[model samples]
Target: MSAPKQDAWVGHLGPAGFDLRSDTMTTPTASMLAAIQSCSLLDDVFVEDPTTIELESHVAELAGKEAALLVLSGTMGNQLALRSLLTQPPYSVLCDHRAHIIKYEAGGFVHSFCLS
Candidate 1:
């Protein structure tokens, strides 16, 4: 048996791919590249970046939420949400067997929230 060649799965490349190896493997659209190029680079935490604020607001409106936060990755967002909800003494989490929160985050729950 031989490994599959690039052409065998060329169509599966970029955002079209179902591959979960890494998000970096996905290609960005020209519009997205343009937007990023023109975007104001700022420390979103300390300084209020207009672009980020606008994006957050837009996302919030679409999701019918009071507000929205943009994190670096899905894992970070999930961890933050869990931390906010499990503020009590007995901090624990319930997740499915294949949940990415446990499997991919370097035991973030154990370190951040003290979850077993």
Candidate 2:
């Protein structure tokens, strides 16, 4: 991949550079931007994206699972995880009070799992 431009925003530390409260504040690096630029634009919903498929397959293999899914966001991932584990009603989840889902997911877990 080509090197990022010297003036590119890739390596710049923006306002959230020192913030450790959230992973969403991460700054993209030159290699990350290059990879994104090279990624295929195929629709992942139809399983036509080679990069996502490969990544999912690799993750599944790493976890010793038969398959894996790649969701669009952390909220989606958390919801799916909850759904997979909490197959029945009266589900209870134990997590840190300051967890991202509890703090930022807008009561998705409580509505879906806790409230049935």
Candidate 3:
């Protein structure tokens, strides 16, 4: 078989380059790296990061929501969505068997949100 294609942006095919289990395995492009280099380093918890606040606000406006939150990972995003929508108990989320949340989140919905 041919060798894995090298990533032009990062200069190497990282460990997840050949793995297709998740989209997070992909490498960032040069533009993405440039953006990260200029991103604010302030703490986001205190809402002091201009970049984070600007991104969140832009996303919220685009989504027609009053506000939005920036989560560190997909797991946190999924859990927050579940917690917000499934406020009452007896919650049941429908998803494909191979969905990442069901397969990789270690039952975060059940443990963190107490979904049935």
Candidate 4:
């Protein structure tokens, strides 16, 4: 058997396909760059960043949580939540078996929180 030929004008191509295998991917649009340039940035450590605070508030309101931490990504957010929930040591977090937090992220949370 032969490898199937890719149609030139197929449904999945270029920006639509989003090939994660290759690094030759599209960059953010000009509007996104402009927004980043124009955005007012404050110290994020103390929750002074307007954008960070806004995102946290928005997520909190949406999730109906008392507070929310503006994490870098879904994995970070999830791991942080788990860490917060576990009071005692030997914190073994339970999550979806194929979750990105478990498979990917190069063990960022594991090293950071010393999770078991």
The TM-score values for the models, in the order shown, are 0.72, 0.70, 0.70, 0.56
Model 2 score (lDDT): 0.79
Screening candidate 1 with a backbone cut-off below 3 angstroms (N, C-alpha, C), the clashing residue pairs are none
Better of 2 and 4 by lDDT: 2
Worst 10-residue lDDT window, candidate 4: 17-26
Candidate 1: 10-residue stretch with minimal lDDT: 3-12
lDDT of 2 by residue, 5-56 (tens): 3322323345433443345656667898899999999998889989999999
Q: Model 2, stretches more than 4 Å misplaced?
A: 1-23, 113-116
Across residues 19-90, which tens digit of lDDT does each residue of candidate 3 receive? 433456566777888998988799888889999899999999999999999887778888888888987767
Q: After superposition, how far is residue 7 of candidate 1 from its true place, in Å?
A: 17
State each model's C-alpha RMSD to the native.
5.8, 7.5, 6.0, 7.2
Q: Which regions of candidate 4 deviate over 4 angstroms? A: 1-27, 89-91, 94-97, 105-116
TM-score of candidate 2 to 2 decimals: 0.70
